[model samples]
Target chain A: MIEALQFEFMRNAVFAGLLASILCGIIGSFVVVNRLIFLAGGIAHAAYGGIGIAFFFGIPYIYGTIGVSLAAAFIMTAVTIKAKNRQDTFIGVLWAVGMAMGVILIDLTPGYHVDLMSYLFGSILAVPSADIRWMAGLGAVTLVLTILFYRDILAISYDAEFARLRGVPVNLLYFIYIALVAVSIVFIIRVVGLILVIALMTIPPYIAEKYVRSLMMMMVLSVLLSVVFNMTGLWVSYHMDLTSGATIIMVAATGFFISLGVDQVISFSRKRKTQRSSRKMLKTKKDAL
Target chain B: MTQVSPVIQVQDVSFSYNREPTLTNLTFEVPEREFLAIIGPNGGGKSTLIKLILGLLEPNHGRILVKGRSPRKMSKIFGYVPQDVNVNIQFPIAVMDVILMGRLRHRGHFGINKQDRQRVMELMTMTGIPGLENRKIRDLSAGQRERVFIARALAADPDILILDEPTASVDTAGKTELYALLKDLNETKTIIVVSHDLMIVSSYVKSVACVNQGIHYHPKNEITETMLQMGYHCPVELIAHGQPHRILKTHGDF
Candidate 1:
């Protein structure tokens, strides 16, 4: 693993992974807390349309993906916000259509034979320095926005109508948040592929949430956990010549299941402790009587 | 019954969903320091009334005046609690964080200062959850969580407190304690609660408005069984008293 750092691509991959961890920590917390996993998963898949548009138009994949992702994000936002009970179908449709569009657009792109799997199943080992810069810039914006609107975002996430009643711009903040989620998917797609982005975004936060009492702490823990996963995954994948994205996601999934088992063990002990305390209280009461 | 300074005035307001009428030509006034209970059956527009007052939904016609200003304009001064908190049950938010949200209105930024923390603690004490500030909201019982939400609403220190089905998740004893808390709170601020627990609510609220597409406003807290039946536009079969036992005799038609 240390020897691999001599390669420029490996160094770039490391930077990309670190940035991805921070982005996932902040935005993924909101996504998980707001129960937007399905919507976010939809956005991750639907970002394929942006890739298609970029390739077909002979533009940079980042710009095309951002454009299409934002459009899909806003459309999904409008649908979910307005169509109270029927948003699932809309998201499903968009998710499928986006993937299909990307496939067809790539098919028609005239000169794209190799390296396609990189986008679908990530090529973290081949991350370019330019993409790393892009990730850093987007990560900074997400951090600043989250810090500035921390209170309003927390209010909106906890209870949107109550936030609206308290004069928080719920809808506007929601749109901006969704937009950021869409844009951030571009960087995540670079690190983990669209197929595995949701796992990386959700797993760390899920584990962090179980241990933390506050969203801020949850975010901090998610970033730390994600970094550990990414580092471990990168090291193992490098040693074994495995797919970096898949390796990372496997590490996170393992962490998730382990956390579940830990929770069960902890809860069992807590139950026993409570029972013992209750018995002690009863005995003391009897002696006093 | 005691007509005094009005804090919220709904004048000839009407609202519709998909061109279907929800509230029609509703006119009412919530006086300062009054506890108003909005009771009606399902699909009777109780939630919609609260929405209109909160400026979430604008009326198709007429207007809502909150403290002589439009509801939207004075939204900062209105504290609202919905039927449910509408958050994921496992959301990682501490009780202090939940209540601290009440102090975020019209604030420039997000840091919780000493005074904000003090205010949150004060509210927790006022609502009877003083020691649970550090507990995760999801870990709390239904009754304690309700108190946290109510304390959150009070944390804003708004002039009006509005709650929709605040006792739905709470038990009977919890419901009574909640009403008593609201009754205590009513001495300083106006409160509008949309509730289906009419019997207990009528005992605490100073005025009752039975909304069913339109509204039947009662001025006194003493809402008789017959008046409630008329307001429901049907027979009041289920009587929610000490225990929710049906006072109606068995039907002979069966």
Candidate 2:
């Protein structure tokens, strides 16, 4: 693992993983806490439409994907706000339509032979320096904005109505937050691809949520957890020649299961201890008699 | 003769959802330092009136003025305590963090200010939930959670404090204690509570507004038979502990 960092591609992979972790740690915390996992999944899959649009129009991938992804995100946000009862159905439709559109657009592109598997399974080892720079820039912007509006975001995530009554501009902030989520989803697609992007955004935060008592702590811990999973998955997949994106998701899933098991064990032991104490007290009462 | 404007004035405000009118031509006024209760049956537009006052929804026909301005623009002056926190119980947040979020105005960039922290602690002390500041919000009991939310609402120091069904989940004793707290808070902050809890409305509130599709403001605690019949389809009968049973008339038919 130490020697692997010498290669430029490996260095880029590690750097890209770090950038992805930062974005996931910060934005993912908001996503998981606010229960926006499905919305995010919709955005990630819909981002495929952006990629397809880029290839079809012979433009850069970032431009087309970001543009279309943001548009889709705005549409989803509007639907979620206006017709909340039917948002799930609409998001499901958008998710499928985005994927179908991406496939159809790619097929329609002339003289283009793009490796669809790479986009689906991710090619972290093949990440270019330019993309890494883009990831860094996006991550920085997200971090600054998140910190600047941390209180408002926290208020909105917990209870949007209360946030509005407190002068938090809930609607405007919600639009901006969803837009940022869309942008982050696009950059993360380069690291883990679109299919596994939701996992990367949610798994670590879900785990961190169990242990931490504040959003900030949860985000920081989630970042560390994400880094660990990304590095370990990258290393394991590198040695075994497995798909990096799938491996990272598997690692996160294993961690999630382990945490759940550990939580159960802790609670079960505590309950047993209480029961034992009560039984001992009963025995002592009988002994006194 | 010039006079101080009421803290909240809803002048013939009408609202609808999906073109189905919920509140029609409702008019009310909440004066300064007053503890008022807005009570009605389910779907009687009680919650809608509160939402309109908070500017979460706009009135279609008439206007609502909070401190002589629009309700939406008066957010800083209105502290709101929703019926339920409506937060996921498993959300990882401390009691203090929940209270500090109320101080989310234009303070500093990163952390809460010293004055804000002091104010939060003061509110915690006042609400009698000081020691539980570090506890997880989910760990607190229902009553304790209500107190924490009250402390959070008061942390903003708003002139008007609005609560929606505050005692919905609280026990009888907790409800009494909460009423006492609100009665004390009314000394400084104007309180507007939306509830269906008739018992408390009879006990604590200085004024009552019976809202169905419209509002009938009663400037005193007495619940008149006419007000009850107008607000609810049937007049509520008080038949407990040897209390006189007032025969209810439904839609003008016995």
Candidate 3:
């Protein structure tokens, strides 16, 4: 892997993966804790429409995709806020529509001959230095914004009503947060593709949530886990000639299951020990009687 | 005596959802430092009234004033404990962190100050759960969770503390203790609670306002027959407590 990094594209790929990991770690923690997995999934899928819009219009991919996805995010947020029960139906519709529109637009594009597989299943190895720089810039902005508004975000995420009472601009922050999620999803699509974006966004954070005691700690631990998974997946995929995106997701999923099993085992043993001690105390009382 | 303005005033307020009226022609006033409990049957606009007061919702045809200002303007002066915190219990957050969120209003660009931390700790100590500050919120029992929420609300040090169904999840002993705590807090802060527990309301509240489609403000802790018949499910005469056999046969059996 060290020797592989000597190549420019390989270095760019590594950089891309690291940047994607940072984003997934931070935004994904919020998605998991806020239970916005469905919303994030909807945004990820809907972003495909933006990709299609870019290709169809012969415009810059990031600009088109980010705009469309943000619009879709705002619409979905509004719908979810208005009719929470019906949000699933609307989100599902938007997801399918966005993907369908992307496919149709790509099909109609004049003389378009790009590998659709890359957009659908990720092409991290093909990442250019320019895209890597873009990812880094976006990552920096996300980190700065998160730090600047940590208190308000924490208050809102923990309890919106209480946050509102505290004079936190809950709705405005919500819109901005979702827009950031949309942008993050767009970049993450370059690494894991739209279909697998949700997995990458949720798995590491879900695993970290059990061990960490605060949102910031969860994000830090999640970032480390994501980086490890991404690096390992890249190396393993290179050796096995497998898909890098799916391999990374599978690594994270494996971690998730392992954590769940370990958690259950610890809780089960703790329960049994307590039960045994209580029963022993009852027997001692009986003996005394 | 100085003529201080009322802490809250609702003037002919009517709210509707989807063009259907939820609350109509509601008018009320909460004076300073009063313990007022709003009680009614489910879907009787009690929650809506609270929402209106919190500025979470607007009245379609009337106005609501908190401290002689609009609800939104006076939002910071009100500390609220929602009926449902609606938190993802599995989320990674400590009890101390949750309580300190109440001090977000006091946060500067530098983040929470030592005074904010001390206030949170003071509230925790007052609520009798100082030992549980470091624990995760998910680990707390229902009663403990309520106390944490109450402590969080008090951490804001607002002039009015509004609680929605504060005792809903509490056990009987916990409910008594919670009311006692509220009674103590009422000495300095105006207390407004929306509760379904009539027994608790009768015991602790200085005033009772029954909200249904309209508003009925009882200046004293008195549940009149007329008020019960107007909005509640059961008539006051039929609710004979402590007898296991005296259940209402129908919605309006009496």
Runs in model 1 lying further than 4 Å from the true structure: A275-289, B1-3, B85-87, B106-111, B169-180, B196-203, B224-226, B232-254
Give the share of true interchain contacts found in each model.
0.81, 0.81, 0.84
The candidate with the higher DockQ, 1 or 3, is 3
- The global Cα lDDT (0 to 1) of model 1 is 0.84
Best by DockQ: 3
How does model 2 do on interface RMSD, in angstroms?
A: 1.7
lDDT of 2 at A60: 92
Quick one: how many clashes does candidate 2 have?
0
The RMSD of every model to the true structure, in order and in angstroms, is 4.2, 3.2, 3.8
Kindly report which residue pairs in candidate 2 clash with one another: none
C-alpha RMSD in Å of predicted model 1 compared with the true structure: 4.2
Residue-by-residue lDDT tens digits, candidate 3, A219-264: 9999999999999888988889899888988887888889999999
Docking class of 1: medium
Q: What is the two-chain DockQ of model 3?
A: 0.74
Docking quality level of the chain pair in candidate 2:
medium
Judging by TM-score, tell me the better candidate of 1 and 3.
3
How far residue B59's Cα lies from its native spot in candidate 3, in Å, is 0.6
lDDT of 3 by residue, B1-254 (tens): 34546889999999998778999999888999989988777888888898899898989998999988999988878888888754567778999899988888663334688888888888888877878878998888877888899998888888899999988788888788788988988899999998877565566888788788987787777665556678855222234565423222334544
For candidate 1, the TM-score is 0.91
lDDT of 3: 0.85
